[model samples]
Target: MPDTALPPTIPTAPVTPAILESLRAIVGDKGLIADDQGKQPFVTDWRGSIVGNAAVVVRPANVEEVSKVVKLCHDNGIAIVPQAGNTGLMGGATPWPSHTGIVLSVGRMNKVLNVDPVGYSMTVEAGCVLQTLQETAASHDRFFPLFLGAQGSCMIGGNLSTNAGGVQVLRYGNARNLVMGLEVVLPNGDIWNGLRALKKDNTGYDLKHLFMGAEGTLGIITKAVLKLWPAAKDVATAWLAIRDPQAAIEILSEAHGASEDNVGSCELMSRTCTDMVLRNIPGTQDPLKADTEWFLLLEWTSARPKAEGAEGMAEKMEQFLADQMEAGRVIDAVIAQSEAQARNMWVIRESVAPASRAEGPGLSYDISVSISKVPEFIERGLKAALDILPSIRPYPLGHIGDGNIHFSFMGPKGMDRETLKQYSPAITRAVNDLVTSLDGSISAEHGIGIDKLDELSHYRSRIELDTMRTIKRALDPKNIMNPGKVLRI
Candidate 1:
C-alpha cells in the first residue's frame, strides 16, 4: 500500500517439464502439486489479502528430501519460496504476484524427533504445528510457552522465521530466545546442522540467529531444538475493567509486584475490540457487569499447587486484585473460578483478530514502544490516525505487558475495498510517524515481509539497511530464497 507504482520485477528461471519431473522424483508423485486446485491454498495467505501464482508446490517429507529439493532448485537457478502453515501477516511466506518459482512446503516433514524431559528440550521438525508441540510438552509435564491464537495451524518453522512473540513474551521471551539450535537448508542447498540442546555455546558465530528471524531470505528452517519449562500447576485468570491505558499499566505493575513476576499474560483491549468480539464471535459475552473504555485480561501461573490449607497463587492473585480495586486503580474485576471460566476469558482475547476482520476493512499496525510510554503512544497515535480519516474507527488491542500493541483502524461504514486501499498509505504513515517519534518500532512482533517494506526503508538508517543487504547477498547471492521478502535487494 506504499504506492501504486510497483517495484522492479526479479527475473526467475523457467520451470520446464524436465525440472518438474526431477522435483517430483525427489519428493513423490503426491509431493509435487501442479494443479491449480492443489496449489491454491499454498499460494494464498491466511488473510486472503495476498494471492500468489506458483509453477508448483513441493512437499518434502524429511530433511534429506528438503536438502535434495533445495539443491535441485539451486543447481537449476530456480527460485524457491519456503512456506509453512501459511499463517503469516506480512505475506512473507506467500510468493509474489509475478512469481514464477516453486513453493517448497515443509508440511509433510511433520515429526517430533526427540523430547528430553530431563534436559528440558524438544527437537522437532520445522513443519510441526505449534499446538501439537505444546501438547507434547504437556504430556511430559512441561510447557512450550509460545501461545498464539494461530498455534493450532501455524508451523514452528514459520514461527521461527518470523520470530513470533505472543502474550507470554513478558515472561518466556520470543521465539528467538526459546530456540536453542536449528537445522537449516541454505539457499545454495547445503545443510547446516546446528541442532544442539546446550544452554551455553560460545562459538565463533551464533549462525542460527541469522535464519531465525530472516523471514526465509537466507535459508529454509527444517528443524529446531526448543527449550521448555515445567508446566504450571495452578493458573489464575481474571478480567478487569480499567479507566484508561495508564490504569492498565498501573494494574500490570501491581500484579507483577503482588505475584512476584508470576503474571504470565497481561493483555489490553479497547472497548471497541471487546464489543466486536461479543457481537461477531459466538459464545462470547461480556465478563464484566459494568462497561469501561478499556479492559485488561490478566493471568498468573505457578508450578506450586494449592492443597492441605496452603494458600494458592490464585488466592494471592484475587487478593491483589481486591487491593487494587480498593485503591481505585481497577474499576471492577472478575476472577475465573474454574478452568472453564479461565478458558472463556482467553476466548475473548483470541477472538480479536477474526472479529475485527468481520466488522470491516482496517489498517493494522503491530507497533510497540517502551512499557512506560504505551499510554502516551496510544493517546497521541489514535488522535493522529483519526486526523487522517476522522470517520475511521480505531480498534487497538494487544499484549501491553510486553509493550506491543496492535493499533488497528476500522474503515468507516460502507467504505469500499478500493477506497480503503487508497487510504492505507496515509493511515499507515500517520501511525508509524507517531511510533517513530516515541522511539517505538513500526514492526514489533511481525517481521517486515512485503507489508512493511516501504515503512522499514523510510524509518531504518542507511548503514543498518546496507549491512542487512550485504548479509543477504553473502548468504543468498542469487536472491533465490523468498525473493522480494524482508529486503528489496
Candidate 2:
C-alpha cells in the first residue's frame, strides 16, 4: 500500500463482541463480512494504491437496514465509511488505514424504484449501477446522460457523491444537475427523504445539494430522483484529427450552431494519449490515421427522428466537418458509418484509464481552467513537467468543451515504481502551482480524497476552508461519515 496521510483524529474504536452481535442481528450474517479476506477489497482503493482496514464490511439490504446499522454505529461513536460500487479513482470510497469501524457497502440495495417517462425522470436506489440505470432509461424510451468508463460498476450514490463529470457533461451537466431530489442517511442515521421529482422547488435551504458532492463526508446518499432526456433517435459520431487545442475549441464553438445546438459531447485527445491506449488496450483501432498532434471525438444527438432524404445529424455533421477543414481547423475527419464504428471510437476513449494501469507507475492530475485557457494550460503544463523529468511520457486528454483535463504522465522508461515516487512531489508542485496561477482548480471532477488531502488544505484559502469545515462540523459533528476525506476536519 502507498503511504497516505490519515486524519489526525478519527474514531478508532473497535467493533467489540457485543457491537458485532448487534450488527449481525440488524443485518444478519448474509450482510456482514467479518473475515479480513472478505473485507480486503472494500478497504482497498480502486487503483490498489491505498489499502485501509475495517473491523467489518456491512452490506445492507435496504434503507431501513442501513439506518439500523448506522444508528448502531452512531450510538457507539464508531466510524462509518459509506461505499457504493467502489470504482472511484480518488480514495473517497476506501476507508482509512487506521479505521476499526464498519465499511458500509450499499451494493445490495440496487433497485430502480420508479420510471416516469412523461416526466423525464427516474427514482432509484443509490446502489443501482450507473449502466443499469442508463439501460433502464433506454428501455423506457428515455436517456440517462452519465456516460463514463466505469459506468458498468460504479453506483449512482458514488457518482453523486463525487459529482461525477463524464463525456456528456458538456450537454447534460454533472451528476448533481441531473438530480432533482435525494434521500440521504445522515451521519447520525437520521433519514432525509427529499425524493421529490420536481423541477422547481424553492423550499428554503435546498438540502439535497449538500449531500450530492460531499463525498460521503456530510451524509450517505441512499436514494435519488434523476432527470432524464428523450432518447436520441438521430445521432452522429465522428473522429476528427484537429490542428491543435485552440482549433479543437474553435471547432466546438462553431459546432454549437452548426449542429443547431445538438452537440452532445466534445472530447479532446492528445496523440500521446491515443498511442498509449492503442499500445496497452487490445482490440482497439485508431479512428483516423492522420498526421496530427490532436484529435476530437465529437458526437451530436437529436431526439427527433431523421426523415427520409432530409438534413439529419449525419448530413449536418458532414457539412460542418467540410467547413472546418476549409477553415484550417480540421485536417481530416470521418463520421461513423455504422454503430460498430462509433462503438470502436468510444472504446478507445474510455479504455484510457485501464490502459494506463496496465502500462505502469504514473501521475495524473484532474484539473480545470476556463475553456479558452485549455491550450495555454496544456502547453505550459507540459513544459513545466518536462523541465522536472525530461523523460516522463506525457499522456494528456480531456473533456475539452468543459475545460476539465486529465493531465497525466507515465514514468521514465525502465524506471521502477519506487524511483518514480521520488519525482512525484516536485512534478505535483510545479503543475499545481501553474494551475493556481492561471486561476484554475487543482482538483476538478475527482474530489479531494485521501490522495489530495494535504493538497486541498494547501490550495484552498482560509475563508473557503473554514466555510467548508463549518458545514462539515454542522452536518457531522462526530466526524464519523467517511472520516479523513474531502476535508481535514
Per-residue accuracy of model 1 over 266-313 as CA lDDT, tens digit each: 999898888889999999878886768899999999987768787788
- The CA lDDT at 345 in model 1 is 83
Please provide the root mean square deviation of candidate 1 (C-alpha atoms, Å).
Answer: 1.2
- In model 2, state the lDDT of residue 83: 96
Those runs of model 2 whose alpha carbons end farther than 4 Å from true positions after fitting are: 1-7
**lDDT top scorer:** 2
Cα error, residue 453 of model 1, in Å, equals 1.1
Clashing pairs in 2: none
Candidates in order, TM-scores: namely 0.98, 0.99
TM-score of predicted model 2? Answer: 0.99
Candidate 2 lDDT over residue span 124-240, tens digit each = 998999999999999999999999899999999999999999999899998889999999899888898899999999879999888878899998899999999999999999999
The C-alpha local distance difference test score for the whole of candidate 1 amounts to 0.89
